[model samples]
Target: MAAEIRLSPCLNDNFGYLVHDASTGATAAIDAPDAAPIRDTLQREGWTLTDILLTHHHGDHVGGVAALKEAYGCRVVAPHDRTAALPLVDLRVAQGDVVKVGSLLARVLETPGHTLDHVVYVFDDDKVVFTGDTLFSLGCGRLFEGSYPMMWDSLLKLRALPDDMLMYCGHEYTAANVKFALTIEPTNPALLARAAEVTELRSAGQPTIPVRLGVEKSANVFLRADDPAVAAGVRLKGADPIAVFTELRERKNKF
Candidate 1:
């Protein structure tokens, strides 16, 4: 049976994911930003929480782990490096480690740009990746604990994945990101079209996440590090490639 993923909104616009294996009814939660919503969602779906996948140690990302574990007695799986601060961790995983939710297996990808402990979960068979704060719909996370180059390298690793892979980022920041892209590439047809689409979606109060990786490669300025036009734009602005990406991200942060 195929894996089923459900998106649950928690703590403002942050998303918490519930991934389940349809065959055995085993389930895992990806980043518990808040416990109340997670508790309510589990009850509504009639699914038991078997494990907690912690991507990082941020309060918004790990705040609910204690409460959820106390309520459900589920194992907490987090990065080995961050377990010292994450007291609820039951399984400490690192890059290349595999964790299971029923029949589905997710490979751990260390992506430490948003935070030094950040890790992404990729379910190859399901063609989906849960990129906590490392990657966003059209933006990347702020380099809180890592440098520009570190963040850029992390993003490059993700860009190497198959284009068809679905990117399930942590936040819903597509509209704002597209607006920033317009400042850098005002004449880009793809960016223009995507901006319009994001406007409509936001107006309708719909989420613009789980955007296809292929779509991001084409239109996402952060992911277009090697594009000649983008490089030229950076040169014209008297900035290097990394500086260009950082400047773009900073603009987005303010947008």
Candidate 2:
């Protein structure tokens, strides 16, 4: 049986994924930035919204929870650590928790960096991961509520996943991120080729996300933790790997 996963563009460039278990006819919305688009997509697909899986507590990521729940009465599953702040979380889940969407089971990964309560959903069977803001296409999220070391550790955890894992990120920021990657790894053939592809895709007004983990490992400067060139470029007058990662993120923040 085929597992159906549909993408619906929500607020600005944010994407909300509708993952359906074709075998069981169960559907779950990854994040609800806006209710209208999600509702429209559900209606269009004739899919019932059974669950709302939230990766983080950002308003743009969870803003439509109340509205969508009111309309569909779906269970809202969010990180247990931030339940006090999360407005409508019905199930407070953490690492090791398994969320079901139809016949698919997503294992929760507590990846804190963009936010202290951020989590990623890994569908092992499908080899797909929904990386909210912790891990982006070619770049990672800015250090907002977390520290550099924390972000680095979180990224390390994600980097351990299978190289072929499909990464579904939060936004359409790959083109701009590739531009920054080129600045750091100007001569990297993989980066150059990926940049060209992203440029062409953006020129056609298409989304440049859902990049593979292997592609990111080869082209993404942030994911190249041991690359000598990246290490040298990000190294301060006197810094270690963590420091290099921090400096690199700082440079990207300004870029």
Candidate 3:
């Protein structure tokens, strides 16, 4: 059976997701930003929360885990957290690990940069990925606990995924991200069209997410750091892709 996915906007700009399987009545929340919205979503969908899959140990992502777990007695899965900042974890996963919510299997890919223990869930059968804070719509997470090179490598791993995959990120920052992207690839037709679309979507108060990886590969500047045009935009022509990427990130920090 096909998986049912729901997106819940929570806590200012954070996004919470629930992936449900009908065959087994198993539902997993990708990240619990807050308990109220997720609880409401669960109640509305008539789906019981059986699992809480965390991508990292960030407070915003795990804040609701405890409450939800207490309410549903669900298992909590998370990446290895040496800091002990997160709540109780029933399972600690790493790269290449497969986690199951009912019969739905999600492969874990370690993607540090947003945080040292960050990971993303790729549901191959569903052609969907939950890219926590590691990747945004047209941008990437800021280098907080990881270096530029580390983050770049992580991004490469994601970029290598199939183009048709549908990507869901942790925040609704597409409008701002696209605005920054325009600074880098102002003349790129794909980005221009995407920007217009984002503008219209935001004007209607709609969420700009669940974008296809193929579309992001064409317009996301962070994913295009290897392109010569991107290098030129940052006045780093003929420079290595990593150098271009670093320059772009630094500029974005200020932007």
| TM-score preference between candidates 2 and 3, better one | 3
Q: What is the number of residue pairs that collide in model 2?
A: 0
- Over 4 Å off, model 2: 235-239
lDDT of 1 by residue, 156-189 (tens): 8899888999989888878878877777778878
lDDT (Cα) of model 2: 0.86
- Candidate 1 wrong stretches, greater than 4 Å: 235-240, 253-255
In model 2, how large is the Cα lDDT of residue 237? 35
The number of the candidate with the highest lDDT is 3
Candidate 2 residue lDDT tens string, 1-255: 255778888988899988888788888889888899999999999998999999988899998999999998899999988543676788988889998877799999998889899999999999999999988888999977888888888888889999988899988889889888877878888889889989888899887867889988888878775677787655453456677787788898888
lDDT measured at residue 169 in model 3 versus the true structure, 0 to 100? 98
Candidate 3: where is the Cα deviation over 4 Å?
none
Query: How close is every model to the real structure, measured as TM-score?
Result: 0.94, 0.95, 0.98
lDDT of 3 at 159: 97
lDDT of 3: 0.93
What would the per-residue lDDT of candidate 3 be over residues 1-255, giving only the tens digit for each residue?
379999999999999999999999999999899999999999999999999999988889999998999999999999876674768789989899999999999999999988998999999999999999998989999888988889999999999999999999999999999989998899999899889999999999999998999889999989888998899999999999899999999999999
Q: Model 2 Cα displacement at 27 (Å)?
A: 0.7
Q: lDDT of all the models against the reference?
A: 0.85, 0.86, 0.93
